[model samples]
Target: MNNYLTPNFAFANMIPVHAQGSRVWDQAGKEYVDFSGGIAVNALGHCHPVLVDTLTDQAKKLWHASNIYTTEPAQQLAKLLVDHTFADKVFFANSGAEANEAAFKLARKYAYEHYGAQKNEIIACVNGFHGRTLFTVSVGGQSKYQEGFAPLPEGISHIPYNNIEALKNTINERTCAVVLELVQGESGVLPAQVEFVQAARQLCDQYQSLLVFDEVQTGMGRTGKLFAYEHYGVSPDILSSAKALGAGFPIGAMLTTDKVAPSFGVGSHGSTFGGNPLACAVGCAAFNIINDQKTYENINKQSQALINELNVIGQSTGLFKEVRGKGLLVGCVLTDQYTNQAGEITKIALEQGLMLLQAGGSVLRFAPSLLLTDEDRQEGIKRFEQACQNFLSHY
Candidate 1:
């Protein structure tokens, strides 16, 4: 038994002693392919040489400099974000939840200050995962996460993803923001239909409401673009990014255009460790590497290969109904007969020296490293095939 106090995480039995790139090793010397990539946080892969070097060099210089003082790493990273994307300003936080919290508050504040409190409704897609904070979970659109946390925050509404009609019906002059996931990562890797996303942009524009994209899971090259919005030719007024920003060093950021950024004025909102030097340094390194055109090409190719291979396996075994999502953030939707076995399939995959993640009850989410090597991909698929065969035998 451990001394930790936490809710059930359904942790794997294997305790990894070490990891490098796309592989992990247990204390017992069992090796496993790391396809989960710490739930998509290791965008550059585990202990990437460049990231490790950046973190170490920054550690030798400075680690934490509270929001009281500006830090160079933070400034550099912020500049990079501003230069590369639609954002004109950036605010750092420690996790996706904090970044999303900031985004939510900023949206409300901007609306309240500019348009009045009447325009304060936020609309998010059903089954879209944001973060674990009270405000985030309240606005996350999944009721089960908020069952015991009432009376939850008000003025937030949920809508079926990709239903442009429902979204149009929901948004009025009162709607303050519409938060969306280009690829819904937690429930299943459901990519937003292009038409629906374009409609969202139009609706927000028609109503003068802010469009927020919770890119916490789909950002930082997860979808073959620096941000998933690039794929659809739509951008969010407020974007929340994390998970992979620091490449395992822990960082989050809320980015917005200049017009809406000033709404978050001095002394309005802040965090102590939001722009820590260590996290920023690593984030900068990861951002520079991932922002490269070559990196995007590699991810697109690798993702297509994995998707093709998984479809081939599905066709051969009839185990999955469809494979969905973009770039490395793909999902294999299991056949109805095997829907409830997603967790068990993951466990058996572990037994076969593979690491995988399940989204909701039926979709197997593959959020592996953007730098996933050809060799690791082949090896992981081999392990997964064996695991599938083993699973079918029992079923």
Candidate 2:
């Protein structure tokens, strides 16, 4: 029983009162290890001292000086992102959707201004999730997200994900941009085959179209690499990033090369609250930590350990069809025998004092904080095994 006015979000009955590191306390004071990591947004974990110090310090000085005349924090963050990645320019926004929206718009604008309006077609892969905005939903692959929103944006087509032939048949010179997620996080934890990505890059190059990578979930060290594109050795002309950018402080950014950036000149695109001082301050702190080489080594070590443990669990109980994914963003793909049991598994995990997520009906998702400790990981595994055992005893 709650008093909030939301018919959209299916609110959980258990309300979290506080969190620290990779753990949360519910209203009843029950402790649960947060394997969800705020759906992969708490990159450095809850209340990392650096983020806390930065946000608090910025809050005391300035919180909301709009994008007109950028602040020092925003400048510092932009410089850091440009220095570390392939981006030559950056645009800040409030969420992943906004960042992606800007990326699409910028691509079309660049194609139109340089090429022509006839080149405005955009191609996205089937089963990929972008964001919830109308334009993004139209560009996104899932039909369910576009069901009620008809008269959707035209000139966008969906092709089978990771199918190079389908991409080859669909993409052409008319295409302005080909958008993709290196790892499909919503439909299931499916990674883009390296060959497919390389083919897409080649196709885009041949057609003179920009390649867009939606790294909203895969960026900021979720994939053991700072950005998933780094894993493939292919670079996108335009990129959208979020989730872990602010380390739970709520921020998103669209990055682009210098050639495509001018398309968003004065009055082209703007956000009132975007590039605000507070969010940028937090983002700067997060960027420094996640972009460090030491962070990647730590992520790789933890990721290997978790992958090994999950495989052992899968083999012993035969509950998981496969354990797949990279770094902290992992998924346990259920076999046909347990295709519809993801919900049950999640409920059981929660009761056992662990939080988990599901990519689809059958994939149990795990996106723990990058800073999740060895102790916490072992405790989470034990609890997870107990939950599976309880379910098996009844089944």
Candidate 3:
């Protein structure tokens, strides 16, 4: 345990090794229900045969051909993403932060090219977690990640989440982009109001700024839709998607309409490992599987069931104030008395064979596999209850 080399993540003490569909086996062979899903990256669960086959098949065919020459898998993935979403063009990247970086750069470039330098400010919501990249960390409303990283990029501003009045007041001629997560993942799994999304879109249109949707945590059927933007019915001019996009494989994509696409011309921006064929191949397969209506419908059902069970547990134990979120991305807001126990509960849950996560303060977050079964969902909730009960008994 070298503290100097490793970064400090909250759950540093309890970590696991082997993983399967809805469960993982630790080094000591302790089986745990995996509710965290690698923070919403494992949409189809651990090592699904389909994804395994896709990855193996692609591995034999090709791995990397460099960005100079585009491969079939990359081209196919780009076309599929473009056809499915409001995007006319797609730029592949290696991670969610890279996707966001591309989206941010494109937004700024589009603004400067068309609307002048004043229209360079990027507006995001408070408590929203974009990523750990320097640019993203600064753009993110969370100041904690920005500490000691002085001289951050200027023109980034924060507005209240789900607040239309605040956005209307702040978003003016100088605004270049308004980035948001349809459901704020790191900030307590709060879904944005439909009206707020619409208003943001209208404001972007009026100001000629790009609307960037950072769908890294909510995309690829996490919300019973291929994309959360589908549920809101308000399309973003620029969208960044990652996490489940590759279904456990590392990949990301930034999508934009034709008008905003030209901002990244020949040498404007690119990534060496951005559109690697193997990643794209897996992404195509994952997209096809999660995009189906039946798959999403099952997700909706399981999400409701989990929420109901969590609420019942909360009512009985008086440990939670509320349970809210769309699909598998749920959060249990701890009651005032148990405020400090959020992290403690997660540790207890891990010890009791249930892996969980925390969002914001006093919120126990759950982002299981989108295709999690009814029985698995019940098992996770039941384990979580046991953890809560044990905590209550002790303290």
lDDT of each: 0.93, 0.92, 0.90
Clashing residue pairs found in predicted model 3: none
Residue runs of model 2 more than 4 Å from their true location after superposition: none
Taking the tens digit of each residue's C-alpha lDDT, what string does model 2 give over 1-395? 55678687766669898989988999899999989999999999889999999989999998887766889999999999899899999999989999999999999999999989899999998877889998999998788899988989999999999999999999988999999999999888998999999999999999999999999999999999889999999999999999999999889999999989999989999999899899999999998899888888989988999989999999999899888998899999988888878888988999999999989889999999998789999999999999999888887
Q: Over 4 Å off in model 1, which ranges? A: 1-3
TM-score each candidate. Answer: 0.98, 0.98, 0.97
How much RMSD separates candidate 2 from the native structure? 1.0
By TM-score, highest first, what's the ranking? 1, 2, 3
Lowest-lDDT window of 10 residues in candidate 2?
1-10
Worst 10 residues of 3 by lDDT: 5-14
Candidate 2, residue 112: the lDDT equals: 96
The Cα error of candidate 2 at residue 287, in Å, is: 1.2
* Candidate of highest lDDT: 1
Which has the higher lDDT value, candidate number 2 or candidate number 3?
2
Residues 77-195, candidate 1: write the lDDT tens digits. 99999999999999999999999999999999999999997999999988778888889998888988888888888999999999999998999999999999998989988999999
User: Per-residue lDDT of 122-166 in model 3, one digit per residue for the tens?
Assistant: 999998888888899988888889998888988999999999999
5 in model 2: Cα distance from truth in Å? 2.4
